[model samples]
Target chain A: MNELVEFISNNLQLLYILILAIFIGVELIKNVPSVLHTPLMSGANALSGVVIVGALLVMLQAKPDDFLSLGLGFVAVILGILNVVGGFVVTDRMLQMFKKKK
Target chain B: MNITLSIIYLITTIAFVIGLKMLGHPQTAKKGNLISGVGMGLAIVATIFLHDFEVPSINYILIGIALLIGSVIGYFIAMKVAMTKMPELVSLFNGFGGGSALLIGLIEFGNFSEDATQTSTIIAAIIIGSITFTGSLIAWAKLNGSMKDIRLPKYNLINNLIILALIAFGAYIVMYDSTNLMLIYLLLFASLVYGVLFVIPIGGADMPVVISLLNSLTGIAAAITGILFGNMVMMVGGILVGSAGLILTFIMCNAMNRSLSNVIFGAFGGGDVAIAAVGKTGGTIKKTTASDSAIMLNYASKVVIVPGYGLAVAQAQHVIHELEELLTKKGVDVSYAIHPVAGRMPGHMNVLLAESNVAYDKLIEMDNINPQFPNTDVVLVVGANDVVNPAAHNDPSSPIYGMPILDVENAKHIIVNKRSMNAGYAGIENELFFNQKTSMLFGDAKSALTELVNELKNM
Candidate 1:
C-alpha cells in the first residue's frame, strides 16, 4: 500500500496527462463520418506504432553484452516500422478514392 | 526526457491531433494521413539523432537495415493488395504492432526497474500486447478463409475463467516477484490462449466488432508502454487510437443493435444450420434474365444499387460503374444504398466502390436511404443478402432478427444478382430473395452486370 501511494505521488503528472489526452481523443473522434471509418481506423493504427520510440530507447540503453535485450529491441523496431508504414500507405490508398460531389 | 526531445515530442503530438481531426471529412482525409505520417517520421529521426542515451557506439547501420527491410515489405504489400482484401491486411498490421509492444515489455523486464508503478505498467503492456497480437492474427485468418469458427461447449465460461485466472496471476507476479522470467512466460502463454479462444467463437458476420476491439487493445498496449517509459508522444498517440477504436466498436454495435458483450458472448451465426427451413419460406423464388433486369433499369426513373461482399468477391465494381453510366445516359438516376455493417468491416463497401470511381455523395447511409426506398423505381442488390434481408424485420426467430437492414423491400422493383441460392456469411436465409416484387438475376456479379450493360447498350 505504501508503494502504491509512492508510485502515484511520484507520477501524478503522467496520470493527469493520460486522463486529459483520453478526453481529447474521445472528443476528436466523435465527429468522424461513417464513410471515413476504415481510413480512420487504419490511420489510428499507424499512430500506435509510436512505440518504436520506446524500442529505440531500449536499444540505446542496453549494455554492450546484453544480447537478449538488444535482439528483442531490434525485432520490436522492425515490427513497429512495419505497422506504421503499412498502415499509412494503405490508408492513403483508400482515402484517394473517396471523391466528393463535383 | 531532455528539453530538445521533449519539444520535438510536443510538436509530434500537435501534428497527430490536427491530423486526426482532418480525417473526419472526405475532402481532407488523405492529407490528414500524410500529416500524421510526417509526424511519425519526425519523431523517429529526432529519437535516433538527438536523444541522449549515453551508451557507447550506437548501431546506426543495424537500425538502418531494420528500417529498410520493414519499409520495403510494408510498402510493397500495401501497394499490391487488392481493395477487397483490406480488412485482412489491417488485421495483420495490427498484429505486428501488438507484437512490437509485447517485445518492448519483455525487453523492459530484462532491465527490471524496482518501481512499483513501472512494474505494474510493464505487466499491463505484456498482457494487453499479447492478447492483441494473437487475437488479430486469428481475425486475419478468419477473414481470409484460412480458418473456421470453432466453438467449444460452453466456451464463454471457459473464456471468462481464463481471464480471471490471468488477472490473479498477473497481480501475484506484480506483488511477489517482478523479475521472474518463467512466471512472465506463463502469463504470456495464458494470455495468448485466451486471445485465440476469445476470437474463434465469433462468426464472420461480427468481424467488424472483433477487428475494432483488437485495434483498441493494441492502442491501450501502446499507451501502457508509454506510461512505463514516460513518453508523451506515445501516450497521446496511443490514447487517440484507443479511443478512436472504442468509438468505432460502439458505432458498429449500435448499427447492428447488439451490445459489445452480446457480440462477444452470443456466438451468433454458427453455420451448422445454414439451410434453415428452406421449405418454410412463404413465397417461391422468381428468376429473371439479365436482359429483363437491364430493361427494367433502363426504364426506371431512379435506381438505388446495393453492393455487398459478393460484389467485391466477383470484382464487379468496375462493371457496375459501367452499368451506372449507361443507366444515367438513358435519363435514369442511380445511387448506392450503403448499410453500415455491409461488408466485413465498417465502410468496406465504400472503399471497394470508391476504388471503381463511385462518387461519394451518391452512396447513402441506411437512415437517409431507408425512407427514400418507397419512392425508388428500381433497387439493385449485387452479391448481397443479409443486409437486404426482410427477415431482419419480419421474422422473430431469425438469428439476425433485431438487426437494422436496408429497407430494399419498399422499393417499387427489387432486382438481385447472385451466383447461387446459398446463404450469406451469417448463414441465414434471406426473405428478401423470395418477396413478390423481387426478381433473381442469377450469375456472378461481374458477369451479370456486364450482361446487363451490354443488353442496355443494344436497346
Candidate 2:
C-alpha cells in the first residue's frame, strides 16, 4: 500500500506536463475579439491566485522530514493569499470609480 | 492531512475561477477579488494545520520574521507608490514571484539526483524562472526611468546565442548526470542576463507589452517548477499567467499598430513620430493672449476641453475643474474628451480627472465625444499634445498617420494651452498649432487655467 501511494505521487510529473501542454494549446487559440481582452486579462489575473491553494496542498502533503518544502510551501501560500486579497481590493476600488453617478 | 483540507483546497480553486471570471467586467471586478481573497485566506489557514508535529523553534522564528518584514514593506510601498507608477510596481512584484520560483527550483535541484525526468524539469524551471526574474527587473527599471529607452548594443544576436548555448549546456548536464553543479549555475546566470537584455531595449511606450511578456515568463517558470514537484497549483498558476500574458501582449500590439514579432525584434528607433517627417513643414503658428482666449471662451455657447499629460504635469486638474464649473454656470455647455491611450498608462486621464472631483457624467470617452466636435463653438486644449495632433488624420507620411485623433480642430475656435510650441512625445511639429482656427495660449497649464478662471469671474 505504501509503495502504491509513492508510485501515484511520483507519477504527478506526467500530470504536470499534460496540464502545461493543454494550457499552451489553449493560449495559442485564444484570439478572442479585442473587446473582450481587458475583461479576459483581469479574469486571468484573478485566477492566478490559485497558486495559494496549490501551495497549501503541497504544504499539507509534505512529509515532516522535508521541512524546507513545508516551510517554503507555507510561505508561498501566505503570499499567494495576500495577492488574491489585495488584487480584489484594488480591482474593486478601480471599478467603483467607474460606477454610474446617481 | 485528509478530506477536510482537500475540500477547502477545492473550494479555493473554485473561488479562483470565479474571481478570474468576475475580473472580466469592471462592475463585478471588486467582488470577484473579494471572493478570491476569501479563498486565499482559507487556503492559508488550511496550510497552518496541515503539518503534524511541532515545528522547530528556529523555523517558527524565521517564518514570523519573514511574514512581518514582507507585510510591512508591501503595505508601505503600496500606500506610498503613486497610481502613475503602479504598472512598474506590478512588474517588480512579478519579478519577485519569478525569483521565488527560481529559488525553489535551485533548492530542489540541489537535493535531487540527476534523473532524466527531474533533470528536464529542473532545466526548464532554471531557464524560464531566471529569464522571468531578470526581464521583469529591466522592465521595472525602464518604466521607472532608471535606464535609457534605446536598445542596448548587439542585444538581439547576443541574447539568442546565449539562450541557445544555455539550452545546449542544460541538455549536456542532464544527459551526463554530472555532479558538477557549476554548469547549472552558469545556465541560471545566462538566463538572467538574457532576461535583462531582452527588456532593456524595449522603450517606455511599449511597457504594456513588456509587462505582459514578463508575466507570461513568470507563469511558464511556475508551471515548470510544478512539473519538478508535481504540484497542481504551480502548473495551473503558470498556465493562467502564460495565457493571460499572451492575450495582453496581443492587445497591446493591436493598440500600437505593431505585430508581436515586430514588437519583440523591431527596435523602435524614433519618438512618437517618424524621423523622416522632421523639418518637412516649418509654418509659423498664431499666438493669442489670455484676455483674447478669455473672450473666445466667454462668448462661446459650447466648449470642449481636451486634457492630457501636460495637465497632470502642471498639477492643474483642480484649476481645470474650477474653470469647467465657471463655464457651466455661465450656461456654456462643457464636456471633456479623453483618448483611449492618453497619458502614460491606460485610463490615466480618467484617474487624474477623478482625483480633482470632476463630475463623472461630464467625462466622455473619445468615440462618444469625437463626433460632437463639428458643432463645438470652442475647443479648450489643456496641456494635450500627441493625442490631438492633426497629423494622425491628414498626413499619411507622418509616423502616427492613420491613428485616430480627437477632432479639436473642427471646433470654430481653438485655444491651446501650452508652455511652448515644442513638439510632443513623438518629437514632431504639430500641424494643428499652425491651423488658422487654432490660437496658442503659451503659458503653464495650471497658471493659464487659473488666469482663464479669474478672467471669467470679471466677465
Candidate 3:
C-alpha cells in the first residue's frame, strides 16, 4: 500500500498524460461519421480491454499463499483476454464492409 | 527503469491514436483497425516477456493457453455470426470488457474495499463496470427481440432510490473500515441489479442510446482501472473508449431528438408489443403481393431501398443486394436510402449489406438520398417504419417528431414489406403507412424478397 502511495506521488506526470489523453480522445472521435458508430463502439469496447495490464500486475504481485487474489487475477486475465481478442476481430470484420460513393 | 519498454509503449499509443484517426475515413478504416490491432499485439508481447517492465511473475503456459483459447473462440464467433446478429455480438463483447474491469477493481480492494484514496477510483470502476456489463446484456437482448420491455410498479422511484443508495453506501464505505469483503462483493451485485432495472424501461427505439451509454460506461471503468494500475497505455486506451462511446451516444440522442439525460433518467417510451393489429388501424392500407410488387419494380426506371432493423432482423440484406443487382440489370438506378438511425446500431445496415457483397457505391445517406426520392420511380421500403414516417415532419405531438427521416413519401410509388402492420420501434403511428402512394406487402421480408426476385425473373 505504501509502495502504491509512493508510486502515485512519484508519477504525477502520468496523471497529467491521462488527462491530456481525454481531450485528445474527444477530438479524435469527432471525425468518425455516424454511420460507423457500431464499429466505433466495438473498437472502443476492445480498446478498454487494455485492463489486461492491471490484471497481469495484480497476479504477479500476489503472495504465494493468497488464493483469493490469485483467483481474481485469473478471472481478470481470462475475461480481459477474451475482451481484447474478440473485440478487435469483430470490429475488423465490420470495418471490412465500408465503401465510398463511387 | 527500462527505457526500451517505455519507447515500445509510446509506439503502441501512437498506433492507437493514428489508427482511430484513420478510422474516420471509409477508404482507410480497415487499415486503421489493423494498425490498432498491431498496437494491441505489441503491448501484449512487451508485457509478457519483459521482467522489469511490470511485476515479477511470469507464466508462459497460462498466458499461452488463455490467448489461444480466447482467439479461437473470438474467431469462430466473429466468423460465424450472421450480419443480423452483429449488435448482439458487439454487446456481449462490450459486456466482457466492463465485467473484466469490475473484477479487477474488486481484486484491488481485496485487502480494503474503501481505503480513502484508492476507494474513490476503485469504486468508480466497479459501479461503472457493473452497470455497463448488465446494461449491455439487457440492451442486447432487447435488440435481438428476445426480451420484452419490463416496467415494475413505481419504476422511476425504485430506480432513483437504488442509485441514491449505491452512492450513499459507497460514501459510507469510504468513511468506515470497509473491512467486510461481503460488502465489497455486495456492491457489485447491487449495481448489476440496478443496471438491469435501468434498461428495462427504455423503449425499443431508444436502444441505440442505451447500448452506446453502456459502451461509454465500460470506457470510464477502463480509464479508472488505468489510473489504478498507473499504466500510460491503458489510460490512453480508456480515454479513447470513453470519448468515442460518449460521442456516439450523443449522436444517437441528437438524431432521435431526445435529450441524453431524458433517455438515461426518464426511461421514456413504453408499450411492450408493437401496435400489432395493422388492419384495424386508422388509415386505409393498400395491400400487395410479392408478384405485384415485383411487377412494379420490373417497370420502374429508378428505385431506392430503405432498410431498418427489421431488415437486419430477417437477414434480408443479401436478398436486397440480389434485388438491387437485378434492378440494375434492367437499367433501374438502384441505391440504398439509409436513415442515420435506421438499424439498431450505427453502420449496422452497411455492415450487413457489405456481408452480402453489396457495393458501397450504391449505399447513400439520408441527406443525399432524400432529394433523389422524389425523382425516383419507386421506393422499396423493407422492414423500416419510424425513420420513413411522415409524422416526424408534421406531427408535433408525436414522440419522434423533429427526427430527420428518409423522404420515402415523395417517391412516385412506395412498396413496404413487413410481416404485419405493427407499429415500429417508436411505438407510434407512422402516417407514411397510411399514405395513398404507399402499398403495404405483408409477409416475411426474406421470402417476400425472394419471391420478388422470382417474379422479376418471369418479367
TM-score of chain B of each: 0.97, 0.88, 0.92
lDDT of 3 at B94: 80
Ranking according to lDDT, highest score first: 1, 3, 2
Interface RMSD of each: 1.3, 5.0, 2.3
Which of the predicted structures, 2 or 3, would earn the higher DockQ when compared with the native?
3
Better of 1 and 2 by lDDT: 1
CAPRI category for model 3: medium
Tens digit of lDDT per residue, candidate 3, span B2-37? 667677878988998898777777788888888888
| DockQ of each candidate relative to the true complex | 0.75, 0.21, 0.53
For model 2, how does the per-residue alpha-carbon lDDT over B1-459 read when each residue is reduced to its tens digit?
456766776686566556655555545655766776677567656655654545555545444454455456555555566655656666666665666566566556666655877777778777887787788788888878787766556777876788788888888888898767787788888888888888877666567677777776666776677666555545655676676677667766766567887667765535433567777767878899888888889889999999987887788989999999998999999999887656655466776776677887687877788889999999999888878888887888776676677888888989899999777765667888888999999999989889988888999
Off by over 4 Å in 2: A1-96, B51-57, B112-114, B177-179, B269-275, B359-361, B394-397
State the lDDT of candidate 1 residue by residue for B100-161, as single tens digits: 99999988976765866677788888889999999999999999999999999889999999
Displacement of residue B225 (Cα, Å) in model 2 is 2.7
Model 1, position B113, has a per-residue lDDT of: 54
**lDDT, residue B288, candidate 3:** 89
On the 0 to 100 scale, the lDDT of residue B87 in model 1 is 89
Q: What's the lDDT for residue B183 in model 1?
A: 90
Residues A16-83, candidate 3, lDDT per residue (tens digit)? 88678878877877857666777877777777777777776666666656777777777777777777
Pairs in clash, predicted candidate 1: none
- Specify the highest-TM-score model's number: 1
